[model samples]
Target: MQKQKTGIRHMFTGTLPQVVASLTGTISAVNDGMHYGWSAPIIPILQSDDTPIRISKTDESWLETMYLIGGIAGLPVTIYLVDKIGRKNSTIVSSCTSLLSWILIALAPNVACLYVARFLSGLAGDMAFVATPMYVAEIADQKIRGLLSSLIYLMMLFGILLIYLIAPFTPFYVPSIVGSLLLITQLASFSFMPKSPYYLLSKNKVDSARKALDRLRTTKNNEAELEDISRAIERQKKEKGRPQDLLLVKSNRKALIVMTVLNAAQHFCGISVMLMNMHSILTEAGSVYLKSTTTAIIFSVCMLTAATFSSFFVDKYGRKFLLITSSSLTGICLLVLAIYFNLKTVGYDVRSVSWIPIACVMAYAAVFKIGLGMVPIVISAELFSNRVKAMGMTIADAMYLIFGLLSIELYKGLSESYGYHVPFYLFSALSLVTTVFTIVIVPETKGKTLEEIQMLLKGEKPVCSNDDDATDNLTQA
Candidate 1:
């Protein structure tokens, strides 16, 4: 009993530093969430009688597209920054940009100012997504890496929920003020966290890398782990990090394909469209029992809750299982929603089933977050070797933004031309396609070390079960 108790206590102590570092770094995601979710509540107000700046439907769509355009623009900058400045500094830069964006939003004089502010926010969000995952993945213990990595999406969901809760009732500028304050808080707190050991080692600062690793791990003796990291870094450095390597190298090619498909599946499911236009969709549904704002709040809350629960299961259940299940269930929900919207569009008296949209959307929030919404972020961080990680992630992120931009536009164009059912049906079909893709293409990565994942990506069996073997494999590879 005493031995068992000691083991449990040691396990808890070992994970504490990792947890703290992850929380501090990922807190920036809350601000990203706020910026992403900001559109949902504010767009309706922009079209209302008490609007500060007048906006037509075209202008509103531009607001969303501009953010995505900015995200695409930021990808090249992020690829450069994450490698040149290191992950921690990159995140700090992201925080500063996010703060500036909120300030601009808070003090905007015209629609152009609003567009520019959103563009900056998108840039910051892209930076955070690229840098924070690498930082967290490099610092975390493999045993809990999935959970720690999932914190990125979990924090994002919290931010979304936060904005959803406040934006409807508060004044136009209140959410921006709150978002700015949170970014400041992240800057202050995360500034004290150590740089990623991988980044430090890549720069040939062995002593600094050791110190950073020490700060992230509870055990005083991390020499073995340090050596393992050094070996891996050395192996990766032997390969040229050219952009062509992302496709020329077999493993890199595989990782890119997997990520491209995953990103496509993630965005084509209409999550961005659903989130950005939730209030409008609900209002159009004509729900007699609840207001659109209230339903939006509930939608965000359900997403957050589902994401929170998913973090606990990611490592245990494995990434492939959760993704397949989430994708399958999400398609079903979307299909149901498509049917309901189609029925309403066909001049049917859907008044008797008015509550279906709410139920479908709420259920979609839960099922989607359980896997499809969160796992890709985690997997993207794990897939690439250090050689092409930055470039690979940037390309994947660009794909994510592009797909998002296209999906949102598809929603707007299809809905305006045909009806809401058209877009929903398209989203539902894409989601089903995603399910098949995950079942065949996406590899299971739960509980694997960075080295093991690379080996798996290379089509080699992972024989290393411990740090010593991982070091041997790195040296031999």
Candidate 2:
């Protein structure tokens, strides 16, 4: 008799449907950033009323301040909530914040209300950024965790697409309706989801953590791996409790420097600003063929597709190669756009020039997502030990948001005052600088355990690159 085939299937097959749903929730929740950043494209609707709220330079300035300031305000809450209540609860709260902000913004009586609503939304949006990654990383198995976390960025791009698609048809209320619907769905769906086992384990809920591990593992044969996971969890807790642990003490300030620089390098590439404000940037470069709404939608769709592909390659190609290649390619694309815009100054107004900027924008988005967008998160997880992963990720994200704010603010004014060429050229130069830094400093972490990564960061030569027998604390309970 033929024996029945029996084994645990891949986690992706069991989880892909849920992953897609979670992806939609995340994308919809964060869509507000694109909505506000491209407010210029929706300005005509905002102004059509008799008593109009002019989206002026002053308004944009206030909006920018609100975003950065609000994100700062939200961090303490996010940090406390993510560890305390677990990732699921924090995401629900964040989604509600976005929902409330959009409703108020859509029906605002004045410019002040708009600013306040956007500010609140920014605070909520930041919380999602913090919690979603943690949840994705926690729920996913070791094999596909990077790809799952990368989905956060990928879904954010889709949110951009939704906004761009809706902006043209019904300016102010449509995007708000879309955002609110997404949040309502998320609020409902996330209610049924289980709390993170990591948080439960931290609170001494080992039995619950074990159950969650079982459910998340999706197989009977996972019993052995499940026990290993529980032990690993215990080991991480003990390691974290030790005050003077080598990994906890910031082993090799050089690794800290490497991860930190790489993290900062991601935002400095101008990926967020370019995708968020694509419409205005294209218009600034003298594109007359595409309307702001159409351009914004196209740009958003391109970015989403590019980011989706990036998730597939992230693990296969390894982080370092992608970072170096993606950065250089992004820089080249920006330089071409810069050159085209600069040439326009001397009366070289060719009809084909319009599409050049569009093509360049797509090219830049493709490369940025493939390298800088996905790799930093992967590197952040791999660079430090399990003991430090939580705090290390927090620090990295904080810096990312801080510099991210600066990049957005700088792009807005720099593009408006200096010309379209200025922002793109500056980002291109920064990308080139980061490319060199990545090649020299960042090491490959593919298929290596966290403890082994720590050893590599310490500059200790290993018997084999993938061997981690020397630093097995992570593998113990």
Candidate 3:
């Protein structure tokens, strides 16, 4: 019993550095979450009679969407900075941008100021999403990479939950002030963390790469791992990583397809609509038992909880299983929501079933976080080789922003014209389609090293390297 206990302790002790590093790196995500969730509660306040800034309906829509537009504009800069300045530095740049955005929000004099603030927030978020995952994935041991990589989404959810809890009760500028403090904290702490070993190796800083790897692994014998990374980098360096290479190369093309579909499905499932419009959606449900603010809090809590739960099992159960299960169950929940709204729309008495929308949406939040909410980001970080990773992630992020923009716009247009049921039904059907796509097309990447994942994508059998053996021994030790 004592021996078994020691073994278990050893397992966790070995990965402690990785966990700390991942958490520190993902602080930016927490800030991004706050920025994303800020609009949810603040929008109603802006639109009401007692408003800080006067805004039209068009202004209201722009307030929510300007972030995404900024994200789209920021992608070119992100793609350039991610590879040019290094992942760690890129994240530092993002932190500074976030700080500025929040300050702008707190002191906004007009709707135009609000738009610029949201735009900078989106730009900062886009940069963080691209750089943070790459930093975490490159630093983590393969055994725990999924868990570490998933931290990005988990932190983002926490940020959302943080804003939800704070924003509804506080003054308009308070959340912005809080957000600025969080970014400041992130900037100060994350500045000390080492750069990714992979990035170091790519830049031919072999000694610095070794030092970073040793620091991350907390072990001295990393020569085998260093050689492995060097070999992979050399192979990748042979291929010229132009934007077109994402299509012309077989492995790159496969990676692009998987990430594209996954990102599209992620947004098409109506997550953005739900997050940004939770207060309004719950209010429209007409639940007399709980206020919309209270229900929205519950919604964000459930999402954060489900995401926390998923982090424990993502590696154990594998990506495909969780994704398929999450997508299928999410579709069912959305379908139920569609039915409830349709009943209310067609004059059927929904008084007895007023709780259905709350239940379905709460359930959707939980189920969606389990897989659809988090898996795409995890898998996106895993699929591409170092060669085209920056480009692939750029395209993937662009798709995520574009699809999110489309989903939000469609929801607004459809819900206004045809009723909420229309968009819910559409989201439900697309979710089911995403389920089919995952099973038939997406590759299971659990437990594979970055090289092995690339090999699998290229239709070759993955062969274990000396580094895998060495890393496995370190994990076991």
Of the candidates shown, which would achieve the greatest TM-score relative to the real structure? 3
**349 in model 2: Cα distance from truth in Å?**
7.2
Clashing pairs in 2: none
Scanning candidate 1 in windows of ten residues, the lowest lDDT window is 468-477
* Candidate 2 residue-wise lDDT, 198-274, digit = tens: 66666778788777666665454555545554665675665553323534454435556776787677777887687
lDDT, model 1, position 398: 90
Q: Once model 3 is optimally superposed onto the true structure by TM-score, how far is the C-alpha of residue 130 displaced, in angstroms?
A: 0.1
lDDT against the true structure, per candidate, is 0.86, 0.67, 0.87
Q: Which regions of candidate 2 deviate over 4 angstroms?
A: 1-40, 50-57, 221-223, 230-235, 238-248, 251-256, 276-284, 342-355, 378-390, 408-423, 448-477
Per-residue lDDT tens digits of candidate 3, residues 1-477?
997676445435667878887888888898899988877788888888989999998997788789889899999999999999999999999989999999999999999999999999999999999998998889887777878899999999899888888887888999888888888888788888889999999999999998888888767788988898899999999889988899999999999999998898988899988877776786777864777678778888999999988876676677898999999999999999888889889989888878888888889999999999888899888898898898899889999988887889899999999998999999999999999999998988877778888898899987654233444664544
Q: Report the Cα lDDT for residue 467, model 1.
A: 40
Ranking by TM-score: 3, 1, 2
Model 3 scores worst on lDDT over the 10 consecutive residues at 465-474
Model 1, residue pairs in steric clash: none
Sorting all predicted structures by lDDT, with the top scorer first, yields 3, 1, 2
